[model samples]
Each structure stands twice: as C-alpha cells, then as structure tokens.
Target chain A: DQQVKQNSPSLSVQEGRISILNCDYTNSMFDYFLWYKKYPAEGPTFLISISSIKDKNEDGRFTVFLNKSAKHLSLHIVPSQPGDSAVYFCAASAQGTGNQFYFGTGTSLTVIP
Target chain B: EPEVTQTPSHQVTQMGQEVILRCVPISNHLYFYWYRQILGQKVEFLVSFYNNEISEKSEIFDDQFSVERPDGSNFTLKIRSTKLEDSAMYFCASSEKGGRYEKLFFGSGTQLSVL
Candidate 1:
C-alpha cells in the first residue's frame, strides 16, 4: 500500500523559476514530514523537514509546507537552479513510530537553463 | 560533514544465497536504519536499529532478514535465502537521535542483483 503518494511523476521548470512538488499522505498519524533530493547514481540527501506543529519550515531556497488537515505537503524551491534538477522524494513518520519513515514515489524535477 | 558509507557498491548473488549488506554510520550517530527500493518503486523501510536492537520493522522485513551492529561502527543487514524479488537498491541511514524532527543521512546505496 502506498501510504504516501506523489501524483506527479515528473516536473519541469526554467532556471530561476519556482518549482513546486506536491505530496499527499493517507495516514493522519504522520506527524513529521521531510523532502529529500537524489542525484543519479547517488543516495538521497536531506533537503528540508517540518514538524506537525509547524505549518512551514524553510532552509535557504528550500521550503516545506505542511497542511495537517488536508494531509498534504509541498516542497517549494525558489529560484530553482539547474543543480536542483533531480529526483525528489517526500517522506513521513509519526511521532512515536520509532523513526520508520514512509516514502512516496519520487518526482523527477528538471530545471532547464 | 560526516556521512554514512556502504561497502560493495554492487553485489550479484544467486537465489537462495545469503548476502550481507554492510554500512558504517557516522561515529557520533546513535540511530541506524535500512531502506530498500525496487526498480521504479518508492523507498521502503526495512528496519530501524537503536541501542543495538530493532526498534521497528515493516512487513517487508520478514524472517529471512536480520540486522546487527557487530561492532561499534558497523551495522549490517543480512538476507538469508534471498529470492529474485530481493533485487533492489538498499540504502543505509543514520541520525544523531530518533527524534521526529531529526533528518537522516543516507549512504550511497548498494545495488543487489539476485540471479
């Protein structure tokens, strides 16, 4: 079962534009959400994360917004750069879930120059 | 910055053979985990190791699977009598604490091909 889902399999945007990737989770118990970026032939790297109590978290150009009532979250990359082109995965976990995360099928983002 | 490291970037094994995927987490990290992703599939959690014991495991982690921190720095996952379905990219991750907000550091995955 896919507890977390990223309906958009791929996305493309021009460099210096905004790239938004959406994610939805079926489980309401998930209290923590995160976004990870992965490059070809490499493991995923942590991008940003948000707690259930907060609606948004930002780190440099990357910002993650969580809508608890809607069970959805989106990652926003401002002024997207070519280097940001990669597969992005959204992951979630509950507060007492022992750090076991559920991941969504990633969205491939391509920023064209 | 310290990072998690996995050995043998690629492994080819026959069905029914036992294979071990090794990982060396950051020395200062206390929580470790194993995750795998089949081709075109989402990354799935296998197990979480904390304090040298399994904290949680998904249905994917069956009797044939086991994890151990054989030494202070090494955490390993062993699949006994592997099946062809076991072919996938296995990732090792670690975090300083098991807190909900802590971000995980993932290692370059080990690609296992079951023949």
Candidate 2:
C-alpha cells in the first residue's frame, strides 16, 4: 500500500536559496511525521520531525510544516548547500501500530552551487 | 557518533540458499527493526523487536524469515530460502524508546543479491 507518497522524483535549487520538498499521506491515523536524508550507499539520517499536534517545527536551517487536515507535510531548507543534496524521504507512523514506519518513495534534491 | 553497524556490505547468493544478515545496534538502544528497499522502491518495514521478542512484523516477513539476538549486541535476520525477488538493501535500525515518535538510528545497509 502506498500510504505515503512523494510525488516529486527530483528537485533542483540554487545554493543559498530555499529548497522545499513535499509529501502526502493517505492515513490520517499517522500522528508522527519525519524527514530523512540519505547519501549513496549510506543509511538514511534523520533530519527533522513533527507531531500532528503542531503545525510547524524548525531546527537550525531545516523546518518541517505539517497540515493534519490535508494530510500533507513539507520540509524547507533555507540557504541550501551542496551538502544538502541527497535523497529525501518522508515517513509517518501511528502510535500503537507497533511503531512501524511507512516511508515515501523519496525525492532527490540537488542544490547547485 | 554511536551508530548502528551492519556486516557484509554485499552478499550474493543463489536461489533457495540461506543467508543471514547481521547488525549491531547502538549500545543503549532498546528497540530493533529490519527494513528492506528494492532498487527503485520505498523502504519497507519487515519486523520490530523489543525485550528479546518480536513486537510486530509485516506481511513481507513470512514463515521463511526469522530474527535473533544471539548475543547481547548482535541482531541477525535469516532468510531460509532466498528468491530472486529478495534482492534489495537491508537496513537495521534501533531506537532509544519504544514509541512511534522515537527517532531511529539506521545502519548503512547490506546489499543482498539473490541470483
């Protein structure tokens, strides 16, 4: 089942600009959402997370906005750098659902210098 | 940084053969999980383990699959009979907490190719 979907296969942005990645979910039961970044041959590294109770969460240059009503979430990175270029994945989980995570196909972000 | 480590970065096996993928989770973590991703697909959850027992498993984790924590640190996933469709990258993850909001630390992954 494709509960989580990242419609964008790839995104390119100029360095020092803003990069926005979007994700949509079909499961309203998912209360927790997270973003992960991964490099070639490496594991996915947690970037940020947001709870359904909150609309926005920011950490350093990364910010995650959640709209529970629309079942959509977006991750924004301000002043994007080349290092930020990687595959971005959005994941969601529901409490008491064995804590299992459902992940989207992923978006490849390329920050051009 | 404390991270999960997996052995045998790549494994090539013949169909119907058995393969065991090993992982070493973070020292202080209490929950362990297995996930696999096909070449062009999203990562799929296989199973979750806690307190030395399986807490949950997905449909992909069938009768032929098993997990074990033989030692205090090592977690292993064994596929009784490999199939060509089983080719994918397997990742092991661990979390400090058991809740859904907890953050999970994942290993680099083991690339399994069933020929």
Candidate 3:
C-alpha cells in the first residue's frame, strides 16, 4: 500500500546546513505524524512528532512541519552534523486505527564534513 | 535508559518450518507491537498486543502468524509455517500507552531468513 511515500531516496548536505526531508500521505484519516532515524543495523529511533491540531512541532534542532491541506509533512534539521547521517522514515496513524502506523520507504541522509 | 531487547539477532530456517521470535519490551510499557520489513521494503505492521490480548492486526498478519505474552514481560511472535517471503527484519516495539499520539520504542530487530 502506498499510503505514505518518501519520494527522495537519498539526500546529501554539508555540515552546518539545513536538511529537509519530505513525506506525502494519501490517507487523510491520519491525525498523528512521526519521524524516525535509523542506523544501518539498528531499529528506528523516535525523533519528533506532530499532531493534526498543530502545523509545526520543534525539538532542539529538529522541527516537523505539517500541511494538512496538501497532505504533506516535512522534517527540518538545522546545523546538520555528521552524526546525523542516517536513514529517516516518516510514519502516520489514525485515531481509531488502533495506533497502527504506516511507514514510508525511508530516505538516506548523508552529511558531509 | 531502558530499551527493548530481542533475541536471536539472526535466524535461518527452512520453508514450512516453524519459527518463534522473542522480545522483552521496556519495563512499565503497556503496549506491544510487531513490525516486519523485507529487504529494500518499508516496515509493515503485523500486530499490536495489550493486556495479554491482541488489540489490532494488519492484513499481512495472517493465520500463519500469532503473538502471545506467555509471561508478564516477554512477548513472542510465532510463524507456524514459514515462507520465503517471511524473510525480513522483525522489530518488537513498545509504547507507554496505545494511544495514537504515543511514540514507540523499538528493538534492534531479529532478522529471520526463510530458505
């Protein structure tokens, strides 16, 4: 099912630059969005999340922006560091869907020092 | 910090054989979930368990699959008859609550290879 899609398979950015990862979802029922970072052989770690009620949520250097009208969400990381290089995935869930999350294929982000 | 733990980092089994993947979720978590990701694919939800019973399951979770909380802390997923397509990284996740807004804490994963 193509419920959630990450069109960019890979991204590269210089250190200290801003990194933006985009995600699109077809199901409008989704009310909660989340971002996850994963290393090569490890499970995805929760990054940040935003609810439908708000358009933006920020934590430290990470910020998540949601555009319900466009059915899109984006994760922005400022002053990117080499340690931030990893695969990022976007997931979403509906209120009555028993918290079943729909995940994207993921985007590999590489930060060049 | 507490983390979810999984056993058998990798397992190779023959098709039609039965396989069980074990996981110990973080202490004090009330929700448990199983998700699998095939090579070069997105993670897919299999099932979610709470209060010792399954609360939700995806279409991918067929009769061949089952989850149980035999004890108080350990949660297990069993594939009665494995298929080649069953080969993937299975992740065990836990959340403080089963609400839509709760974030999940996932284990490193158990890679199951069905030949």
Candidate 4:
C-alpha cells in the first residue's frame, strides 16, 4: 500500500546551494523516521533521523525536520557538494517495535559542480 | 566499523530449483532482518529474527521460504522450489537493542535471478 512515499523521483542542485528532499507517510502509527544515502553497488548508509516528539534534528551539514501533524518529513543538506549526490531513501517505523522500517521508492539527488 | 556482509553477490537459478542465500550480520547486533526489491520497485520487508527465532514476517515469505541462523555467524534464507517471481536483490540488515528505529544498517545486497 506504500505507507511511506517519496513523491519526487529525482532532484538536481548546484554545488554550494541548498538541497531539500521531501517524504510523506500515510501511517500515523510511525513515531520515528530515518534517512539513508546510497551509491551505486553500495549498501545504504545512515544519515540522520528524528523522533516524532521533536520538530528538527541536525548533524553538521545535514538536517532532518519532522512535521508530525502533516505526516511529512524533510532532509536538508546545506551548501551541497558533489560528493553529496546519491539516492536518498526515507523510512518510517512505529514506536517500541522490532518491525522493520517501511521505505519509500527513493529519490536520486544530483549535486552539480 | 561493523557492516552486514552478504555472499554470492549474484545468483542465477532455474525455476523450481532450490536456492540458499547467506548473510553475516554485525556481531553485536541483536536483531536481524531480510528485505528484497524487484527491479523498479520499492524495497519490501521479508522477515525479522531475534534470539534464533522469527519475530515477524511478511506475507511474501511463504511456505517456499525459510530462514536459519545455523551457526553463530551466518544467517541464511532458503527458497524451496523457487519460481520466476523470486528474482530480486535481497538485503540483510541488523540493529542494536531492537527498537530505536534511528538506524538499520544494510548490506550491499545479493541479486538472485530465477529463470
């Protein structure tokens, strides 16, 4: 049923510019959200995450903001670099459960130099 | 840094044949999961295991599928009498303490093709 969705199939941005990726989820049960970055022939690596209780979480150049009332979340990479280009997946999981994360189809990001 | 490892980067099996895929999760992780993606499709969960038993499984994991942690290091998925629809890239993931949901490390994936 695609409980999680990344409507944008791809995005492009110039180096030193801001890049934003968006995601929406239909499942209100989800309380935690995560973002993963992947390159060709490589495993997805953890980027950043936010709990439903908080509105925003940041790590250096990357930031994740969760809007619980909107059932939406976003990942923002400031001053994007060429190395930041990759496919980004947004995943959602419910609270206190071992249930696996439901992943979106993924959005490819291109940071042009 | 610990990472999930999967064997036989690619496998091509005949329809109705048996296939076994293997994975070695990070040593300290307490929970393990399997996910698969057909080309051009989103990743879907197959199963989750903890304490040598299955904690959860998806409907796609049917009678034809089985999972085992035969030893301390290896986690395996066996598909008995496979079919054409079984072709997909399967990923193994592991997490600590079971439920933070902040991060779940994934493997590069093992591509299986049933012809």
lDDT of 3 by residue, A1-113 (tens): 78999999999999999999999999999999999999987889999999999999999999999999999999999989999999999999987897799999999999999
Q: DockQ for the candidate 4 complex?
A: 0.71
Q: Candidates' lDDT values, in order? A: 0.94, 0.95, 0.95, 0.90
Order the candidates by DockQ, highest first.
2, 3, 1, 4
True-structure RMSD, every candidate: 1.2, 0.9, 0.9, 1.4
Over B34-93, each residue of candidate 2 has an lDDT whose tens digit, in order, gives: 999998899999999999999999999999899999999999999999999999999999
By how many angstroms RMSD does model 2 differ from the true structure?
0.9
List the DockQ of the predictions in order: 0.83, 0.86, 0.85, 0.71
| Candidate 2 similarity to native, TM-score | 0.98
Off by over 4 Å in 2: none
The list of candidate 3 runs beyond 4 A from truth reads none
Candidate 1, which CAPRI tier? high
Preferred candidate (DockQ higher): 1 or 2: 2
Clashes of each: 0, 0, 0, 0
lDDT of 4 by residue, B1-115 (tens): 8899998899999999999999999998878889998886778899999999999998899999999999999999999998999999999888876766536888999999999
Q: For residues B6-93, could you state the per-residue lDDT of candidate 3 as single tens digits?
A: 9989999999999999999999999999999998788899999999889999999999999999898999999999999999999999
Task: Give candidate 2's error at residue B103 in angstroms.
Answer: 1.0
Write candidate 2's Cα lDDT for A24-90 as tens digits.
Answer: 9999899999999999888999999998989999999999999998999999999899999999999
True-vs-predicted CA distance for residue B99, candidate 3, Å: 0.8
- Rate residue B17 of model 3 by lDDT: 100
